[model samples]
Target chain A: MSSNMMTEVLNLQANQLNAGASASLEAVLNAPPEARAELSALMKLAARMKRWLIPVRPSSAYRARLRDGLQLAAGHQETHRALVETRPRVPQWGWLIGAAALGSAAGIIAMILRRRQTRKDASVAESAR
Target chain B: MEAEEQLIERAKRDATAFGELYERYVDRIYNYIYYRVGNHADAEDLAARVFYRALGNIARYKQRGAPFAAWLYRIAHNLVANFHRDAARRREVPLDDIVAVAEKRAGPSQIAEQNEDARVVLEAMRALPAERQQIVILKFSEGLSNAEIGKLIGRSEGAIKSLYHRTLIALRAELVKRGAE
Candidate 1:
């Protein structure tokens, strides 16, 4: 048989083909003596593979430990979130400091302007006399 | 499926729900890892890590059309790969474990024959490529259908079918050689 034909037969025996296609292929496999032997061997191998299916489970202690670990992790996450939410916010000192500096500069400017106005008034009074 | 999704969503928020998920998938994940690592201790450690990692990232897990178990399998697969790489050695399935497994299912009259077959099969399986080994394990051990296996392995159903057929053929050849010996 061609490799494709062999692949098809093996695929059929793998039970991967659709129901209708599998039925026809099963007939084809059964019709030929060589194919029948091949199919038998495949079935035997399939049966042997089932020995691996003996469900091996982790120990009970292991399961308990895993559960505890997950709980601890979840608790830690919740605590961290709460801490973030409840922590006091630091005052923004930079903005306060900036406003103070601007106020000081405005006061200094006003004082300088007042002195200049007084000097100009004394000069005007002397000219009028 | 919808119920599982609701459990998963709850798991993201509730520890008890997550614990429920753990109970559901721990054995399947452990079995997958055990066969890959071929030892109980590493499998346990890796399985623990798999769940820890899953829980840590549970909030970020999106369904994406695959089951939550698929995500867990993917995590297990990566950790097992890393374990193999870090260990820099392929651990063969211990002969005793194979004998134990076979004896559990086979009668005393058939123990010797079944044991030998189990050993040969495991040895042959170890010789297969990692992906092929996974395919065989998922198909046989977990009893997952092709579509499920494909989702876990990131393969289409057709691709999995071809790989499985090839795997069986290789196993048959290996068994024949072992019998001849």
Candidate 2:
């Protein structure tokens, strides 16, 4: 390849690492067979460097809000979490558990009072007889 | 086959499904951030912040006209921009920093090449206003479409592709002239 062509080829090679990578590669692959053959080794080298250097992966989570005021769900919140922190998210569950324990204890206390009343009633009847 | 559709579907109601998305993109985002910030500690922290911001704003995500990854990079670009803006540093990466990535991605010589690539790219990146680097990293390393990239960075598609192509030419010349050193 001429030096200018080499520069063009190398620049094209760089784009193979761009976000437009597939498009660029498709453009090349669709070219004449001679061109493809000529670029094959360079393509492989570019691919190798890309895979090694600028490997593409989505490591950041993207969130776009379409409408306002909708509550976003929380995820992977350890960003600023204290080592010993455990956040309570569901208020309903806490309320339910507390209410249930309270109800159970009230039931037991009511049962004890009823038993005492029955014994008092039996004693009053025996005294009357 | 359909990464975007799968991410959108899982992210719909399941909050933990967002974590799955986090798992999918964490390393790539980390590396991208690492490439920019040039440190693992900062990369990890920024990576977490990016996801945190995503979770905080998940309800606002619109999958139409934009791929999921682009939106995330948009957030990352903003955070890194703010980071550079508020810091003592000019966000210039030392050549040695690429060495850290070297051990994992390539051998010593390959590391040298990547380091050289990093030097060239980082200089060009730092030479650019923050806005340009935002486009460069997302377009080149993250492999986003110009339209997708434009949406994230708030530029027209025409402007993006042109800028992208121009940046590549500059990057190549810069690398060849100074990178192999």
Best candidate according to TM-score: 1
Q: Candidate 2 i-RMS (Å)?
A: 7.8
Candidate 1 TM-score to native:
0.72
Off by over 4 Å in 1: A1-40, A85-129, B88-92, B105-109, B173-181
Error of 1 at B92 (Å): 4.1
What are the per-residue Cα lDDT tens digits for candidate 1 across B91-137?
A: 66666676666666667769878777766776777667778888888
Deviation of model 2 at A4, angstroms = 15
Root-mean-square deviation (CA) per prediction: 7.1, 16.1
Q: Residue B131 in model 2: shift from native, Å?
A: 4.1
lDDT of 2 by residue, A1-129 (tens): 343454355456556555445425664566567666545544543453344346433222322231111233342333234332566564688889999999999999999999999999999999999
Docking quality tier of model 1:
acceptable
Clashes found in each candidate (C-alpha, N, C closer than 3 A)? 0, 12
* Model 2, span B60-100: residue lDDT tens: 67777665766787788788877777767554565445664
How close is every model to the real structure, measured as TM-score?
0.72, 0.51
**What TM-score would chain B of candidate 1 score versus the native chain B?**
0.83
